[model samples]
Target: MNLIRLVLCVCAVFGTQLAQADATRYPLTIQSCNRDVTFNEAPKHAVSHDINMTHMMLALGLKPHMTGYSGISGWKAVTPQMKVILDGLPELASKYPSVETLLNANVDFFFAGWDYGMRVGGDLTPQTLTPLGINVYELTESCAFVMKRPPASMEDTYNDLRNLGKIFDVQDRANALIAHMQQEISEVQKTLPASKPRVFLYDSGEDRAMTSGRLGIPHALIEAAGGNDILSDIDASWTRINWETVVERNPEVIVIVDYSEVTAEQKQHFLETHPALQSVDAIRHKRFIVIPYVQATPGIDNVLAIQTLAKGFHPQ
Candidate 1:
């Protein structure tokens, strides 16, 4: 008789929780790359621990709710306003915050750019977070790599914003952002033709010269803007290429990616100083394009970067 009563009590408790779930209404239902999340209303507290993820959240107008961020150590590319937010938060050791600092913030949600399931010794996962009542939303774009899926394009980027719009319950805002980016890209694309400009992206430095390949937004932007990304012919979004191969290609346009302390002027000086580049087309005609480290990578700023390159490439 006691066992029967206990079973009945357990069922009553489970039923109440189900009833509560049914009674609650979530305004947003979003399927991110890693998980499906339902926001009861609008998220009032958010922390973007991923660099790319931070851009997406900012694009969604979640800046007001941001509790913390990672990778803001003297951000070379963050706007003055973003810098204010950076100053308020503790400096992140890497892309994500240390477990202790994150828990101390006592946030309701944690938005990450990449899945650190195994990277962090299996500590930062939704499964682990469930106990704390915290949820994780991994950027859909960033998850493409692990899913063995193809990288996204401007179109896919719009789609991502659309998904985020749904999650944030900001459909109108998302559309406007996408439309603005589209128009800007169209303007830049119109400036370039299919003549196929040979562009070499000098993305990294002596430590390790990083180049964007097929998987990253850099190559996507190059393809969309009608510039032939020399590294695209190779595979991978970002990779290391030999200087010997670079000297051999002798591209017509040299896009010096400002991914380090080296300024644009320094890159130009390097080109001029190189014995092999004395007669290069980019150096001769000043076809060299300098891109900020942030703008050179993915995010909304890419359109502006394309516009800059368009102006330099056409000069009309």
Candidate 2:
């Protein structure tokens, strides 16, 4: 009789724990782009896309919830910051996965951006997935025209981290992370040069010079780093300009965006060998600085990019 009573008591305790755990007390609803997203409970299985989006998940301590992820192979290499948090998460694809693959993964949530999962009528968009009861969140900067957006700034990065934290019930971690980033940015901004140098961001293109413009985070990064984006006059995030136009502007320093396909050395060589750039100040003086392609984008690394450019541009 004592053994039977002991078993019944144990079962009662176990049942109570299960019932409490099953209660979804916080039903979260937030406006994301064109859609109203509601999360009845935190997602147990998730899929993330692109470096920045994946980094956000890991930074928020959501790695255990991420059943699978995609787009890690595209980076030149996994950054040290990403390496520690990644912790052997399964990679679903080197790039974006197909709608069928996403469906098969049985992910309850998707953390991706416009180009990552929603490519102009491509499958696996929030429009298609939300109907199936999957929650989706877009990287704020990538939501540029999908919704009315403020100008790209470090605030966008903070908002993303904060939103993800709220969704996953980790608001404290998000606030702490944002505070650290803000402090770092403030320190770097204090050391800026009195005069901003004219900088040309070399992203990759032999035929035409493709560079960053006023619309994207790179433009803000240039401004923060004590340099002026010579192509800032352009309204779009990134655009193409001719070699003659480059000569006309005559940037004082060249900031080469490093990626896997085109080495910074190759771009430096192209600038040095081109006849049109013979008299260009940056090329002639060989004042070239290389930044990782990921750092040039909006993410946790943007602060580091700012500090790097400050040293390169002001090198006094």
Q: In terms of TM-score, which candidate is strongest?
A: 2
Output the lDDT of residue 16, model 1.
Answer: 46
Each candidate's number of clashing pairs is 1, 0
TM-score of each: 0.75, 0.85
Candidate 1 lDDT score at position 18: 28
Write model 1 residue lDDT over 204-309, tens digit each, in one string.
5653456766666777776776777777666565568776566667677888876446677886787667765566666677778887655665566677677777
The 10-residue segment of model 1 with minimum total lDDT is 1-10
Count backbone overlaps in model 2.
0
Evaluate residue 142 in candidate 1 and report its C-alpha lDDT on the 0 to 100 scale.
Answer: 54
